[model samples]
Target: MKKNLVRIALGLALVLLTLGHSIRLYQHPLLSHLDAITYDARLRLTQPGGQDSRVVVVDIDEKSLAEVGRWPWSRDKVSRLVRQLTDHYGVQLVGFDVVFAEPDESSGLRVLERMGATSLKGDAAFLASLASLRGSLDYDGQFAATLKGRPVVLGFYMSNGIPQGALPPAVLPAGTFKGRNILFTSWRGYGGNLPAFQAAAPAGGHFNPLVDFDGISRRVPMLVEHGGQYYESLSLAMVRLLLGNVPVRPGYAEGGSGSGYAGLEWLDLPTPRGALRIPVDENVATLVPYRGGQGSFVYLSAADVLQGRVAPASLQGKVVLVGTTAPGLMDLRATPVGEAYPGVEIHANLIAGMLDGSLKHKPPYALGFDVVQVLLVGLLLSLLLPSLSPSRATLLTGAVLAGVVGLNLALWQSGLALPVAGVLLLILALYAMNMSWGYFVESHSKRQLTQLFGQYVPPELVDEMARDPERYSMEGRNAELTVLFSDIRGFTSISEGLDPKDLAHLINEYLGAMTTVIRHHRGTLDKYIGDAIMAFWGAPVADPDHARHALLAALEMQVELRRLDAPFAARGWPALQIGIGINTGLMTVGDMGSPLRQAYTVMGDAVNLGSRLEGLTKQYGVGIIVGEATRAAVRDGVFRELDRVRVKGKDEPVAIYEPLGLAGSVPQAVLDELKLWQQALRCYRAQEWDQAELQLMNLVRLNGDCRLYQLYGERVAHLRQQAPGDGWDGVTTFETK
Candidate 1:
């Protein structure tokens, strides 16, 4: 009980920390970013992907610029487009995503007037012509005349720079929000339309989107303040105009005032159908409920509209937006849906969401809800996890995580935008804390056993020993095991060519690589003697496939040594080669050393025979040599019998084989060659010198670089000259160790 108390206290502290981040008592940047990411993921998953025809973007694309002249085209051209949209196509509402801040003077009226005042003064023909062309030459007046008495909403922009052009009347009057503590996006200046355009429309809205800290434009301020006056966004203005110019009113939560929180939650617009509520966040901004990618709404080229090339029914009753998609105009935005999304589409999505009441709401009470959620989930996990076993704790944690994600998604589908990152992170933190505490603090005896055996055995075996520590020790015992020995060929000469420092580094690298291969194959590394390595399997933790593991490790050691060739040459060191031998038999294993310094090792005749096989690899011209027992134990292994030999210390001859590879992995060509070699060896043992010589000649023709074939070829020739009697056996005896 006392042990669990510390973990419980630590878990609770994590809960409190996450709670602080949730309620904004303090902010965690990583948690906030994660919340944004999760919100984007949920939004994308639930978005209805089909196109929405209710809102359309009249794009000023590159095609339009190429067909017409460059941008800031004569106002007469723009006026014609407006007349075609409203009179010919009968669009329901037209909102501009672009602002006309300067007057159009491309009609040459100013130049003609100046010439009349100076260069061509008092010329009667010129004066009459000028007087007659006055009405036709006034382009700005033409554009304003086209805008009058139409359901067109001009767009403006807000900023902190100096005010430019003219602003329309505010949506909320001065002093309307005097005592309220609503947090609106405030600006000091704006770039509005010209006076004539604003007066002709009598309704204009700002097109400035609210860009978050990560540079993604995810929301727009529905009501922004400029010089103590509140103005609606272009999307809001168009929606109001479509609903018969409904009055905008602030909607607040009922019980917020009691807690001194009077933040506005939504904007209410009373229509004939009902009161349409547009949800807003603490900054009076609403999330843009993106329907899909860039083509969520239909896009018709502005040039098509001007030239009467568009179908009339496509624009009928459609709420149209006029904006540019031309790259030179730079109206692209980084959005959650795409990095290069059209800015005009943002307004269209908002207008569509407002009409359908699908705008996601992140109300002020969401913070309180987050606080409560963290408290419930964090406390439940904190108290329950410490008392549960590991498997049960994992299952419980998984269930809680699923529940949290599921509930959050459900709320998201219902138009709520509550954060889920804090609670999810809290659950994971608590689970990890409890699990780590249990492993490190409670299992002291297992840790001691791990420390003792970790140096000699692989970590996997040590983990198994930890499960039942009483069964494993350094005490010596006899066990049927497989032992391996590997030595670097010509290591003495290789060391003589390099400096002492270089040699030391080389040996460390070689030893490290070979040891890693041994551990990877589940072999216990017994020791390293100079440039040699010794390892064994089926001790400490017994493996049923000990012979297979030892053979695999020996084969891999040679391959690993070859991999060092290029790097060694690059460092001015010689290419390295190693010979490995593996044997399987009964042997003594465990801690075996003097009292002065103890070591865990293995010994017996099998160990000594394994060493002898490693010494014969150079003579056989093979990388790995294995005794008969190892080759027999591994039924899946492919080996070519090298010889039957009696070493210096043993009188009984043993068959030795060179491991080709695993059965399926060995090349068919190599297997065929091995068969021919076996035939030749059988003939040589039978004293059929002529047949053996013929087979050796064919093998040398196939591969002239084979040292084994050459060595046997010399033996056949020598034995033909000095033939032994039939009483002699076929065993080759090695007199040197």
Candidate 2:
């Protein structure tokens, strides 16, 4: 009960911790980012693998660098590439995954004008020549003129530090929203194109992806805030530009009544094709629905278009993104499917998804859904597990885990992004708690059991007692019990030829096997003396049918010895044979010994008689011998009455019996021999020596190898020569132990 209480306390603590963390009452780093890793795996598993033909990439790859000089190839060269896309290739629109912040001065127009003013001021022709090439020398002007009326949008970045370059006007300018307050991810700085290029295009947008805590890009925010105004992302801005420069608006969800706070749900872009809805989370972020890895979009080299070597069919009416694929340019990103992904392709995926509406949805209330999910699982497992067995608890926990994953997967398949790692971690934690409560918390009693019975018995016996230790003890007590004694035959001779290690191993293995048989019948071990073993039942934990259990255990031991014959022979060792003796009577059993050491053992005449019977087994040429008391106690057993013998330390002769098998399971032929043997004993006691001798002869003829029959036959012959008195009873006497 104390263990269970501790488990309940731990469970409650875990639930409270999770609750507090989910509700933001407390913060912990250990439990954070687990959801991000699990979500990465889910995204990888469910990635819709195929090429998205809507957006194509014009990569400034190595081929382009080799063909068209190095990076920052003069603006006039870029001008030709743009001209071919618009005039020759018939492309729909283009976007730059770059920021042209610095002016291109590769034309040397400033140098020429400076030389004319300093050295050729008197030469009007030289000054006039430099003035005549003013329009041609201005490369920035050349590139800006090419982008004036084309369907093009330039890209920029926003940072939290400070404004780096000029930022374009917001899609929904400041003071455009009313009534409820809304918040957006705010940025303080940006890297924008030159003023001339910005003025030429209709608009520009930020392309800042919200990298997760682990530095992997999963969600790209649809809107960012600057000076209390909201601006659209590059993907959103690109779609708006593609739809003939439609108007973009902020969408708000109805918040709780009178809270004066609203949830920004989506960015609505009005277009002639149709009105497009871009869903956003509370942070205004959307999970990136990656179609595949890097090759999902078509990649064309910029040099191919400038050199006029590409077909127009590939570029006609295709949305093109101009970005560099060179590693040195540092436009690479880490994604679920790849370690080095191009940043431009990320925008392409997002824009393509916005066009086709394959983007996944993760709303703000999904956090509440995760909290409730964890709590419900915790409650159900805590209530259901304490009443179940260990195996049943394990089975139930596995089913719950499977169900959690299955339900989450089904939701993911339908494009709903929910938290999975938290629920899974909760189930695993609760299961571990439940299992550990039983194992570790209850281990004190198990330690006690092992200390009391480790050497005397097998591990299985201690394990059985560990199930309920209160019922068993080492304290001495008197009880009606059955004691067993067993020893190997000719062990001294067997050990003389073997090494000490081999001999010890052989003995330990034999003893171990016999002990297992004894414990299997619920018997408690007393002690071992050299090659002998002593065990008893109905003591430590009592059994009413101790005699039957002892008898069965003895029979099982003999059968086990037989089964070891081939294995022992294969080891080049001699075959082993053993004798067992069992007796049932009142005896003192418990932890009894000298001051130096005490052991859990059995004592009294019954135990001594059990030992004496084991010694007599060899004399009678049998595997086992049981006292008449034990035979009577186990009434369901079939036995052959050997003789009424007076052993050492006993005045009255006790009847000894050999157990054949369970009742009705013994062979009829053995029963016939037993009947004839009984008749022989009766006639010998009646002093009818001739008739006794005749019965013994018939018994020996039926089973010649039986030593009991031969001994009786010889006794009848001796009694015939010297006739005994009528008072003489048929009994055997032994003077040795």
Candidate 3:
């Protein structure tokens, strides 16, 4: 319980730390920039890419310069271009993305006026012509006259550096905002159109975009505060004119810091048609909902507008923005969709969005929504991870992540912009914490179990237990398993004849070879006595065919002993002979033994029976002996029944047998000898001494030096002489092992 609590606490701590860090650094420039990048990707992913019929771009591209006289063309020609847009194309409104900061010098007005002022003094005829042509020579006045009261909005730039050019009055007076301390982008300087143009145009606005820290134009302020008044943006001004000259006011959300402040989030416009709410971010900025990369709107060359080459249907009732797409003009900017987007199209997109109410909303309450999302996901996973298995936990985490992404995309499609990175980071942090707990805590226990298994079990079984350590353990338990016991024949006499060092070397070599055979059949090594070996099958790992496995190991041990005989002869050592006995029954197996003397082994009557069977192998003169239960479990093995004996410490008489090999692999001669031997044993059991002795003589004739057959013959002869009553059952009883 304490460990589970600790795991939960660790998850919570990780969640709290991550959420706190994200909240504290929420305004960090790097995270803000990353958030903006994801917002841009969403915009591009969901934005409808098609021509915006309401707004059109009058591009002053390379073709325009090639056709026209070049940049800074005579103001008279510019005025003519403006007249063409208004009269010929039936344009609703015209916005200049370029500023007339300085007077047109190409008109030759200053030189002609200078000649009249000093160089051409006393020249009445030239003076009269100049005075008469004064209106025609003032090209700046001509451009201003064209702009006068025709729904023309001129664009200007707000700056942090030194202010340049003529300035215009604020659209909203300073101190007009109410409630709390509001922060908007403030500028001390601006570069605007000439005074005459400012006075002549009915509406004009600053066109500076809110280029992010990464220098990408993602948003633009709808209103900027200067001194005390608020100036409108070019897109906002254009929208205002299209809405019949609505008045814009600072809009506030209902609930806030109780300072009633929380800053400006949007702009409210009261139009004669209806009031409209223009959503803005915290900085009173609106994200630019780009329709597509470039060419989202109709594009016509300024050269074409001037030459009257455009179709009327193309420009009729369309709002036009006059801006340059030429590289020399440097009016292009980096935006979310394109690296070289015309600065003018940004205004067009904004204007079109306001007209149709398609602008994406990112209100102040979105912060609260984001916090709730992060909390719900983080806490849910943090609480859930500790209780589930690793595979289940991973599946749950994936489900939650997919849900988060699905919700975020749904909100995006609804035109509501919410942050995704914070929630993403929160999920990852929680998952990492949970996975780390599983690795450092649970895996440590698993590693210990694997090491223990390696010591007493085969590598294949060890790997199976390592995958799930709890499935196998050293705790004592009763299970139906198979046990095997093996001992060398006359080991004490052989060891006493050899030197101590030679005996040790021989024992090690023999035990090593026998162990290899046992391991080959996936049997567990229980323990080793001085000249005996004890092993079992079925666990530390489970094997359903434990009986068969033990039988195979016993058979192979004799085979390996044959291979070692040549080496033992070369060392001047007698060939080793071993007898193995196997039994299959319920036994208690685990790390048993007292604390200062512990060993992994098996216990129970079945184990004792296995040892007694090994002792009887010499009595029967056989290499392998098995109890009746073991022979019953191994179906395909060839076994010959030895006898039914009530061994010491057991009340029931148990039958024993000798296993030769698999039925298919044993020779026919061996099978025939076993048939004759079994007939002699049956005849002896029925007290037919003559028949048993005659059968034994035939068996001895078939196989010479058969001690088991000879011993049975002697038992039959003795019983024939000693029998006195019919109470004889012919069952052998072993009083010692």
RMSDs, each prediction? 15.1, 25.3, 29.6
lDDT of 2 at 536: 88
Least accurate 10 contiguous residues by lDDT in model 3: 254-263
lDDT of 1 by residue, 704-723 (tens): 99889998999899899999
Lowest summed-lDDT stretch of 10 residues in model 2?
252-261
Question: Stretches of candidate 1 above 4 Å error?
Answer: 255-261, 438-737
Candidate 1 vs candidate 3, TM-score winner: 1
lDDT of 2 at 257: 31
lDDT of each residue in 1-737, candidate 3, tens digit only: 45568767877776675566456644656456667778888999888999898898998999999989688778898899889999788899998888888888787889998888898978999999989888988988888888886778888998877777766668888657645566589998888888898888888889999888877998899988776678989999988887787888666676332445666777778876666878898888998889998999989999988988998898999899999899999988999999899999999999988887889988777877877887888778878887888889899999999999899899888878988877776677777776776456457767798667787888777767888877777889999999999999999999899999999999999999998888889999988988899999998888989999999999999989999998899899999899998999999988888988877789999999999999999998988889988999999999999889888899899889999899899999999988888888888888788999999999989877877887887787787778835887667888998
Clashing pairs in 2: 162-189, 163-189
Expressed as tens digits, the lDDT of each residue in 4-78 for candidate 2 is 676667776777777776776865555567777778888888887888777889999989999888888888988
Model 1 residue 136 lDDT? 99
Top candidate by lDDT: 1
TM-score of 1: 0.62
Question: What shift in Å separates residue 46 of candidate 1 from its native position after superposition?
Answer: 1.0
> Which one wins on TM-score?
1
lDDT of 1: 0.91
